[model samples]
Target: MTEPERLRADAVRNRAAILRATEELLAHHHPQQISMEQVAAAAGVGKGTVFHRFGSRHGLMRALMQERAQDLQTAITGGPPPLGEGAPPRARLLAFLGAMVELVARNKGLLAALGPAPVATAPEQEPREEHPVYRAWHGHLSRLIHQQRPDLDDDMLAHVLLATVHSEPILNALEHGAADRLERTLRDLVSGLMPEG
Candidate 1:
């Protein structure tokens, strides 16, 4: 029995309302196009309430992304063969990359809302690695690639692979009717890297 096990009523209601409003707004607009003020108004709560609940727009986006991201993470860590445990390195790697493509596509609007940090031109520029989603994907892919080829720099390779799914490229693919080609493209890339059995 803990705090969440006890479950406060108002907190539950507020959380539900906020999430519902977020989903509604996100359906038609990118995350960056919306704001805390808009979310508060849509949620029927004060701005303070929004801040209290989610800290910032980034936090709100992260909370929304977490459920979907967690699903992919669970599959990679424990779900089943090919995507999870007990699969050959190449199979699992392909599955992981494919899953990433799906996740990015599904959350296209959210990623647009949480774009890559602006290029650093000054001391006041924000941290470059602020997106938790990218960090998670990179870490997971690094581990998988490292297991396959210790001779390669897995971290850099992971960055390069994940870069393929960045919002700019993905959104372009979607517009040019080439989005369906992404998974196959990744499959070919990974196969070329790892070579066939």
Candidate 2:
């Protein structure tokens, strides 16, 4: 490959390495305790590399979240079945919620770290609505809800459903082996929203 192409490839590899290292560190240390220096050391790159790639700790966490959610995003955007484009709106909504429960269960540590702390909040923190991932999920839900129930306020309802899946109570339930009950409740909530055919 040409010089520029080689550099680009190297950058991609470096980015992946950094994300993997961060994931490893998050598995052991609290997110607040895992610094860029540690990430660089584990990733076999310079501290500057981590900062350069992600800008800050928050940015790194967001990148990690995006990476973890990439597969779900792809399946939603292109893959077949209820999670994708081929199913009814209610079915898609149910599938999406089910997938999100799995995702949140797997990444609760990272997700909790990424969220605002109740004790010490960042004054200039971005709103949840402004986050790209939240926007994508909300937009998808809004569209599906609108398709299923045109008379309802799709935007608010989407937010409510998304909140239900991402709420701390749900996360705690997942941790406590209450996934079956959680799923049933979510399914019932969504099903109740749809008009009977």
Best by TM-score: 2
Per-residue C-alpha lDDT of model 1 across residues 123-154, encoded as one tens digit per residue: 34444344565677778888888888888899
In candidate 1, how many Å is residue 5 off? 5.7
RMSD of each predicted structure:
4.1, 3.1
Per-model TM-score, in order, reads 0.75, 0.86
Model 2 per-residue lDDT at 93: 89
Candidate 2's displacement at residue 89, Å, is: 1.2
Q: Candidate 2 overall Cα lDDT vs. reference?
A: 0.81
Q: Write the per-residue lDDT of candidate 2 for residues 1-197, one digit (tens) a residue.
A: 99999999999999999999999998888788988999999999999999999999988887888877777889999999889999999899899988877777767667777763211123476667776677888899999999999999999998887776556667777768776677778888887878457
Q: Residue 135 lDDT in model 1? A: 75
Q: How close is candidate 2 to the true structure, as a TM-score?
A: 0.86
Best by lDDT: 2
